[model samples]
Target: MLMELIFNLGLLLIIVILLILLSWVWPPDSPWAPRWRTKKETARAAFKLARLGKKDTVYELGSGEAIALMVAASEFKAKGVGIEIEPFRFFLSKITVWRKGLNKEIKFVRGNFYKEDLSGATVLYLYLVPQTLNRLIPKFRKELKKGTRIVSYKYEISLPLEKEDKKNELRLYII
Candidate 1:
């Protein structure tokens, strides 16, 4: 029994090490955008542009640490979903949501945001770079319904803007 226990522990340790290494190496081929935490001011601007309501479901792509998700849920009283590719940030955000008692309002999923279905989202929030935005335009066009709001910080989407906040550098588009 002692020998079996030792062997099991050694195998567990090796599995843990492999997982750690895999987590550290960002998937280059995947549409895994870099981590960019949106500032409170910027998040507020995007939320305002979205005009969120109780019925609204806000989905934040590349939601690093879920700062924007927290703001949307707490301030705007909207249901928020955050998708993060990075394992560390995903766990951190999940813990934060639980600690804040915002788990009812906010959800953090550890997966590629590109594969997530955006059809149900009333407001789509993004802080992605120009390349990612361009790449996602077709997906957005295919998935989003009419009157759905899209708020992008820093990088602009190829679509015509419904409203632009020059101060915060945010662009709002309606699908």
Candidate 2:
């Protein structure tokens, strides 16, 4: 009985390690490859720059691991929708949110952010490249409501800059 228990424990450890390894490796081969999730401190600073509040619903593009959304929900008490194209990453995001008891505040959609309807979002948080940001400008202009806020990490969006946290490499804009 003791040997069987040890084997089962070892099997569980192996499975946990496998999941961790898979989570660290980029699963997508497209432009979203080498997923760079915004660091926790950086995400907090970006959300603060955007002035995210409890009433806001922040939508994140290429939300690998949904780190920003998790921070927004847990730290700022805001709701969020994470758009992740990779299925494995999306699954991990869902699990993370669930484990953190933020499932009620965060939702994950395994789809292209460009194709998703972001009309309901009051704030947009993205850490995409400049080219992708430029491509999404048209969609942002069309779907996002007037006075909508945006918090971009590293790259600046085309919208008028409202605030900037240069130390954190974050930019805020209003649509």
- Candidate 1 overall Cα lDDT vs. reference? 0.84
lDDT of 2 by residue, 82-103 (tens): 9988887888889989999999
lDDT of 1 by residue, 42-100 (tens): 89888998788889999998888789889998898999998888787788889998999
Which candidate ranks first by lDDT, i.e. highest? 2
| Cα lDDT listed for each candidate | 0.84, 0.86
User: Where is model 2 more than 4 Å wrong at Cα?
Assistant: 1-35
TM-score, cand. 1: 0.80
TM-score for each of the candidates: 0.80, 0.81
**Candidate 2, residue 125: lDDT:** 89
Residue 1 of model 2, lDDT score: 100
Runs of candidate 1 with Cα error greater than 4 angstroms are 1-35
